[model samples]
Target: MRNSIFLFVLSLISFGTFFQAQKIGDGETVDVNGLQVSLNITNKESVQVGGKPFDRYKVSASVKNSSDKSYTIRLTSYPQIVLDTGIVELDCVNATGAKLTSKKIQLKMKTQMINVSYSAYDKSGKSVSNVLPVIGSYYFDSGDIISDNAIFIVPSGEKPEVNVRALR
Candidate 1:
């Protein structure tokens, strides 16, 4: 009976911690596996995609890998919009250029390669080439802090706070 109760309590704690999310606002940092990541809303505007208008938010994500072992992180699954109505998951594009899905990154050991991944597109639904990184993966050596920006579109008039799931 005592062991069952202890196990139940332990499970409850683990479950809560697993689902816990951190609301990281502009310039706020979240640490995961000794990697420091900060996100900020750099700009916002209305953009045309597939002949429809959408509100797009340009977010800058910075990551510093300081751990001994490498880690892979997914930006599409981790980034979310916190609004008054509810939480909105950012739209993502698959590798084949399809919609409704997300992105992932790889952190290599030894060399400390931080695989930063994001999906970005321009007005014509093409990969952006201006100041933003395109829809692909990026790598950085270990112990190096790098800053990159991505464009995420959502409903109009909803200024959502950036929420990131710090997963291990």
Candidate 2:
């Protein structure tokens, strides 16, 4: 039928129009100590979560260790989300969703939170921080844009390994 042919042509046009579509935020690299850290968001798709729809994005953190010895450090993503009110500065400790390589270096890809839900209230019911409001559990419209930066945290030793007995 003519309708079927028209549908096929429409599909082909859509593919040709966006054949080389890239992620929203990509092509960014940084150095953490002696390691190379590259961050990118890809595989974007419209998904539904908790009775709400969202455009979810997958984040990839590729770390390359050039040093001979393996380094032990955690990757903390500091996400700055732009909300309708203002930019919400996600805390380092509270927003560390995934921990990076504790042994070797490689690609650490994970699905990020699309419809992130959080209230700005402490146990005492006090508004401690500004909220990253989610509109209707899906669309996150704000004045500022959401952005992220990765930090390499050098884990501190639990206890001193000094020879206290020997010194005594």
Candidate 3:
């Protein structure tokens, strides 16, 4: 009887540990390139730019993957940046302060690098017009995570400004 009770208690402890390991949010998995990708965003805060009494916000994006297979993902901006000169650019920035001026961009895991360059051009060979700055970076490994904070700064004056701070 004592042996049976001991066995039961051990089994319960093992089961609890197993459940804790597999437990995740909503049990949801993201499919990426035939593999499951897991991502999460936290520490989100929004504020008006320059206290101009305008509606502006800031969000921190955190992405993660726990699958055994490795995958590559690119963090990209939703709306393209429109410059005052009527040029639409990708709005990507690198550690060296280089900007990516492309339309469609991709970041791969094999290379573990992000390359953003010019992609489209008008009849005059000039870039299209965009106002937002490039706001994305690269991720190389699974279970590997990256984060960035974005801020939209709208001055109280006649112009609206957007500021981005990258938190890797």
Candidate 4:
């Protein structure tokens, strides 16, 4: 009876540890375009795009900003990619021809769907560019710290559109 009880207690402790590691919830708020936007993050077993498996440690972030003020936000997944040729590569791209080779890249929130807003002016005291909504998929070989950021332009005023399905 004592052995059985010990096993049961160990099982409970293991389960509790697993549950505690899985965290999902709303993240911090930031000024995107000209509006205050909130971000939501959720954990998933895997993330699929176009029916292709992207990553096992998958999470989704929902952004809320504006349609004005040009800015770029970026989301990074913690994983490293090594090509079969033994070359390490990181790919980041956007519709506007913006691309980056590092593990980190900046995304634009220019649409009204994502929740980015404009906020301030530039050094020239002119209204900043519109904010663009960006969706990013990261490919890595190992687990790392996953983080997302909402960037805003000075003298902000624009709000961008974000697509919900893209995050799925």
Candidate 5:
């Protein structure tokens, strides 16, 4: 009887752990502390950033508040590109060709923020687009959803896996 009880408890613990650590697939939504996040590669193209042509990817990222509470968060981390060679991360430049400066969000009432890909410029205002926005923090209220796109430069013909921070 003692051995059976011990085995039962062990199995229960294992079962609970298995549920908590489920693997998330590409484009699947993941819940992090009551926030739901989804990231997927939408398209790919070849673009020139600094007189050199490069292959860039358009990634769509969205965040939704799954909780009833309002909270503020900071996006201090950016997504990574997981490749067979190594992991890669790129900076998100704004239209003015400057790096994004905001990383804080005040989500209220389950709100969300989405980042989309657009034309990125340099200091000279030249068209250097296809860069992903740096993941920063934001606030969310219950039921709020934000979606946006970002551009990331990677190798041609290589569909690299996007590694968003929430998946970790």
Candidate 6:
């Protein structure tokens, strides 16, 4: 067996039984010990800074304990977005951090990566009571599309008639 190191900053529960994953993405759901956890992304706003336009994104994370036993859960999001305006001081914050910024204006924020860690479960099946983290980033480049399977795209719109581009 190959042993691998995890990037988890903090995890208390092993959750071997419900170890679905360590990182999550937008609109993705994870189940742990009869608890349902989901993450989502939404467009917050658009603004112009220094004559440059910028966009803001908001990430909402939530956990629902569906079991009869009372438990606590915490969720955190690690945004892969990077701040790159070519300015040293302006590029200090990350894409995820800028989304949470109250100023509501971030420049050249581009989403590059996103990760979510959940409140681990112990052998005794206990959890921590903490609200899930609200993460945000700029750009909807689908920076967190982590699918191992193949992807197929089917475009559906105003289909052009066959004779439209035929013999003119």
**Model number with the top TM-score:** 1
**What lDDT does the true structure give each of the candidates?**
0.51, 0.34, 0.34, 0.32, 0.51, 0.33
> 50-156 in candidate 6: lDDT tens per residue?
45555554444444445464321222345343334210011112242232343112212233333445676677889854445443443312122211111111122
Candidate 3 per-residue lDDT, tens place, 1-168, comes to 999999999999868744433211222443333333232223223334333343232323333444564433444454433222110111122111212212111222322333445556789998775443454533346565543443333222322121121111
Q: Where is the poorest 10-residue window by lDDT in model 1?
A: 82-91
Please, what are the lDDT tens digits per residue for candidate 4 over residues 1-168?
999999999999868744433222245444322333333434323334445443222222333334333232334442323222111111121112112112212232332224445667889898876675533422222121123443211111212222211111
Candidate 3 stretches with Cα past 4 Å from truth are 1-53, 72-139, 153-168
What lDDT tens digits, residue by residue, belong to model 1 across residues 40-130?
A: 7788887666776666766667667777754433234423332221111221221112133123222222222234555689788898544
TM-score of predicted structure 5? 0.40
TM-score against truth, every candidate: 0.42, 0.27, 0.25, 0.19, 0.40, 0.28
Quote model 3's TM-score: 0.25
Per-prediction CA RMSD (Å)? 15.8, 22.0, 19.7, 20.8, 17.3, 21.6
lDDT for each residue of candidate 5 in 109-162, tens digit (9 for 90 to 100) = 222345657787788989875745453444455787766666556444545444
Among all windows of 10 consecutive residues in model 3, the one with the lowest summed lDDT is 86-95
Give a tens-digit lDDT track for model 2, residues 1-168.
999999999999868644322211245554333434444544444544445443433444444443343322222433543232211111122112223412111232222343544658778888764445332221222121224434322223211111000000
Error of 3 at 61 (Å): 0.4
lDDT of 6 at 113: 34
Could you give me the TM-score of model 6 versus the true structure?
Answer: 0.28
Where in model 4 is the C-alpha error above 4 Å?
1-25, 32-37, 45-56, 66-105, 109-168
Candidate 1 regions with alpha-carbon error over 4 angstroms: 1-20, 48-53, 66-142
Badly placed stretches (over 4 Å) of model 5 are 1-26, 47-54, 72-138, 166-168
Segments in model 6 whose C-alpha atoms lie over 4 Å from true places: 1-21, 44-55, 72-96, 99-168
